[model samples]
Structures are given as C-alpha cells and as structure tokens.
Target: MTTPPPNQNDIQNGAGSSPPRQQTVALVDDDRNILTAVSIGLQAEGFATRVYADGETALKALLENPPDLAIFDIKMPRMDGLQLLQSLRAQSALPVIILTSKDEEPDEALGLALGADDYITKPFSQRLLVARIRAILRRSELVRNPPEDAPGDEQAGTIGRGRLRLDPARHQVTWNDRSVSLTVTEFLILEALAMRPGVVKSRNQLMDAAYNDDVFVDDRTIDSHIKRLRRKFRSVDPEFAAIETLYGAGYSFADG
Candidate 1:
C-alpha cells in the first residue's frame, strides 16, 4: 500500500516544501506613513500585506480570515493595538508583533501584558523587524505542522496537566471541559511548560519559545506576559493560579 500524500492543511502549513511566496501580513497603524512604509517593506520582502488605518478594521479583517502574521502599532485611533490583540487572541493563533513609539519600560511591559508576541519600540531597524518576522514564522510553522511521531506517539492528541488540556491538533485548550482562550504567545508558553509538566522553564526558555530566536528581549517582557497569563487562569478557574513562579528562578506548570 503506497502511503497517501500529506493532507491539504499540511500543504498550507508549508510542510511539503513549496513554501508560497505570497503570505498575507496585516499591518495596522493610524499613521499613513507608517502603514505605507511597513506595507512596502513587507511587500519588498515578498509578502502580500493588507494595511488598515485602525485597529477596528484590522480586527474585522482578521475575524473574516486570519492572516499569516499581524503587526500593529500600539497607539492608534479608535481601538488600540492592545485591544486588537485581545480580540485576535480569542479567534486565532496568528503570530503578532507590536510596534510602539514609547521607549518606556512600562509601555513595553503593558504591551507584552496585552498579548503581543514581540514588541518593537519605534525607530526600530527595518532589517531587524524582517528578521524577527521570519523567526516567528518559522516557529509557528513547527506548531502548525507538527512532526510525524513514531507509531506510538501518533495516538497522542491531548497534552494534559491536571485539569489543563492542550489539544495541539485542534489548537484548542481547555480546563475542566471548558475552553480557554489564549493568545498565540500564551499558548506557545503553555505548550512548552506542559510538554515538560513538572520541569521548570526559565524565563529565557519561554522567551525563546515565543520569539524563536536569540535576540535581546527585555526580561520584564516575560514577567508581564506571565502575570497576564496567570490572571487569565485565575479568572477561569481560581485554583489555576497554581502555575507556580519560583522567585527569581522561573515557572513550572504542575498539579496544584
């Protein structure tokens, strides 16, 4: 019996190798100059980009059909990047990178807290941005198109720790039979933790999981996201505050 070819989803995920040249990237910013500049840059890099002048429009487009990746400026008219990220977190696991004009740590911290996968403060190098985008795409590709497991491992679908269940195939997460909405960054962080269960994952590890490359990312960026993730768990199931933080060490997802 000849093995059948990989499924369509696998092809779409870049699993079978003819990586498409035209990938959709949604760029959101109120400034026409910034929007035009980013769209042009991405287009030059062989990506098809959609420019939105406001977060509201971007969110609507995302809900209609998710993009390969999304980059949003933090400050915008009407809905801001944070709000758009929050909404997108509920609907898709698309990679997100946030752009901001503020260099303040607090602003950076807040953007991370709001579910941005990576934060780029204004006056950033375009080359660096493109590099980061490529890195994020590579990482997401792994999750979107998982490796074929050895015969025994093929049966596994749900990765669980107590009541938390991560359904990698469906990209759905649940706690006590109820679904949990996590941003792409949050899901990747959780997946990394759950893969090891009792093992503690240092902040750097989590950072690498989200960004997929060794670049200088603020340590506080991790802390802010963790705080936000913990709050989300607390809201869903109070006992879920169990995701432990080992003062100055790192974090571990284990049975509470």
Candidate 2:
C-alpha cells in the first residue's frame, strides 16, 4: 500500500527503501482513482510511487529531482501530458509512458513524436503497466551499467556505420558526430537495425529486440517509434536517411 503524504503533491508515497535501490515511478493524472490505484500497484512490484494531480506539478518536480520513469495522463489542467512531454523533451530524455483515455491513433502518434517511449490507453491493466515500467527500467539500467565483457572501451562494443555510431553499452547514438537522444525503445530498435546494415528487420523482430517476452507491442507501435527515430536523426542531419523502409517487407539501416 502506498500511503500519500499529508499534502502529497510532488512527494514520494509509501515506505522508503534504504536497503535495495528501488526505482521510483511518477504518475501524473487528474483522476484520483488512477493515481491511487497505480501507486499501490507500483509499490506492490517493489517500486516507489510519486503521484501528481496534474502535468504542471509533475513537470517541475520531474525536471528538478527526476524519477526512474514517469506516466502522464493526456488530459490535465494547468498543463497537459503532451505539453509536459514536449517541454521535458527539450531538456531531458527521461523515459516516459503516456496514458490516454481516448483510443485515438493521433494521440499515440503525437506522444511518440514528442519523445515518449510508450503510450497506454486508459482502463489499462495494472499488470501491463507494471510490465512496461519494468521493461523500460531494465533497458535503462543495462545502458547505464553494461556487463564487464560487453566491450566497454572506446573502440569496443560500439557499432559504427558511416556517420552513425551505436553504442550499446551507453545506449547512445550519434549522427555526423552529433549526439542524438533516443528513448530506450528507439535506441534498441536502432541498435537492431544498425547491427545488421542491409538485413531488413520486421516489426515483430524489432519488438522482440526491444521488449521482454511478457510485454507485447504491435506493428504500429514499431512504426511510430521508427518515425520518431527518423525525426530525431533528421534533427541533427537533415539529409539523414540511413533508416530505410522496404514496402511489404520491413526496415533496414544503411549509413552510406
């Protein structure tokens, strides 16, 4: 059970984990039910929860203190989730999963385009939410601390394809020597494509590379991520076209 503080705004809920390194998840939603239910749900999975009544409060605290991950509801007063996401993307690459009450593709597409790692519709299952948080956290951790034998040096474990460089250990990518921030999902997807330059990777294959077996994402999700990836690369280099789409097939990478 996650017990909110006296005021509860921008504050951590539940008992503190001074022993193990517990990841904290910030929930920004106008709905009290969602805040309370999701808080307890995340606590049950050994994660600390921070509940915000709206996106405005969450954005301020998130930028100052930050969290392991954040879930933002699309509709909110003071500031909406998409606005918060867009504002946050201007400063941080914090892993974010947006919650949308509407079952519209446009919302999902816009969120993804604005640097959200994932999006979930309202009335989502607690198990699925917890699963997504864990999956993204795991990837984030791997990027921070790669295995000893995983090519950690300057020249090792880094895949260089012409002007693009993929560093699996750091979960980083660069185009034309300029840095490009990508979400955990985007980084993994790009890594998959860069690892095998000419070989096309289907949406299913990409979903496998980035996500765990328990969590599932569809083809459109992959497509959205790909679009964002291109947008990000193009931000650094306008002529960026390494990511190729083969109609009726899949996507491949070719830096040249």
Candidate 3:
C-alpha cells in the first residue's frame, strides 16, 4: 500500500491546524525576475504579496489600499522609488524598505533621509531580505499594540521631554506644541535619546534602539537619520538644538 500525496487543502491547512492570518507585503520593482522571486519567497513564508513594476502604479495602489509593509526598487521607471516615498510620507507613515544597487549608495541615503524605514542593496540574500521585513513588521506591530502593563513612558506609549512630545501609538511627534513628522526609524532614535536626556548614546546604541538586532546598518545611516531628525525639528524651530552631537563620541539630548 503506497501512501497518498497530501491534498492542496491539507497542505494549506497543515493537515489539521488552520492556516494563520497572512500579512501583506507590497513589492515594487522594475525587475520582473526580482518581483517573482521575492513574491514566491514571501509566499512560502506565509505572506501575501502584491507586485508592481513601476513606482507610479505602486504608489497609486498603496494609497488606495495600504499593505502591512512595502519594498521598493530605487531605479523604477516613471516616478521612481524616492519620489514615491516622498509622496507617501506626505500622507501616510507606512513602513517602507528601499532596494538599491551597490553603486546607488547616494540614492539609498537619499531614500532613508526621505523617510524610508530601511534599505537593502541589490543582490542581497533572500534570507536577509526576509529578516529585515520581519524585523520591520515586528517593530510596527509593537508600536501598534504596546504592552498594557509595561512601565515607563514607552510603556504608556507616550514620552515627552521639555517641549518635545512623542506618541508611539500614534507615531506622532510634537515640539513646542507644533506637530512634526518622523519616520519609524527616526522616531525610535529620538525616543531613545529623549528617554534619557543628557545621556550620550553612541551610534551603535542608537542603531540597536532604532533597528532590529539582525540588521547591520552602517554608522553613516545613523548619521543621516540624526541629520534628518535635526532638520525636521529645526524646520519648525530654528533655535532647536536639543540634539547635541559629540564628535568622536556620540549624541546627547539636552535636558534643558
């Protein structure tokens, strides 16, 4: 008696247990091969994927119906990833990761500065890409559903220092009662600094607080984020000097 192959329903339902809810990921790239490969991989990992070949289409679909997360190729035709990100940031705080090539470091930096949560260079390992996606999703989930019994301002999902107020749940920041927008990564970095005012935080420390442990971001990434953070705050208040940079050391938040 030969054993029979599993049916499609059996496989989908794991023979007995029910399938878990699928998280949706939007993959926007000009490369069909990349889109297919990534979509297949993410599907295998129990995620639902929506693929678009250009930034314009992706941007339209994303705004019409947002996904749990988004990954974009920086070299897309039409609007391009950076432009799409700029447009999206103006309306939504959606988590976005940009894909770049080795030679597109400047574009990658610009994407991050523009509000992308993370970036991966082209020819990246699928495992690493998935890890980054998972890490970002985890952070997003945490922000959405904070622990009810946790202590501290972070637990309360709101922190304030001086005139700066951060609401993790709402993903909102306000300085001197003026609303200021920040990327997810930027918010985490600012929250860490504001949590311990006057305490210097090394680049590594900031990265740990802002990004997943598995993500190995460069020092320049932190610098770019900090630079953008300062710019955003300073735009509202030119005298905003709460973020003090310590050369050869790190950064500190002014207590007063």
Task: Please give, for residues 1-256, the per-residue lDDT of candidate 1 as tens digits.
Answer: 2222221111122234434455777778877777656666665676766777788878888777777788888888899888888788766667888887755656666667666777787888889889888877765654455556622323656776778888665566788877776766787888888888778899899888866554456777778677777877777888676577888889988864
| Superposition TM-score, candidate 3 onto the true structure | 0.75
lDDT of 2 by residue, 131-249 (tens): 78887887787554556676553667688899988887777788888999877878988999988899999989998887667545657878878887898889999888899999878
What TM-score do all the candidates reach, one by one?
0.71, 0.78, 0.75
Which runs of model 3 end up more than 4 angstroms from their true locations? 1-21, 142-157, 167-172, 176-179, 213-220, 234-239
Best by TM-score: 2
TM-score winner between 1 and 2, please give it: 2
Give stretches of model 1 more than 4 Å off.
1-21, 90-92, 102-104, 142-179, 202-205, 212-220, 230-242
Q: How many backbone clashes does every candidate have?
A: 0, 0, 0
RMSD of each: 8.9, 3.6, 6.3
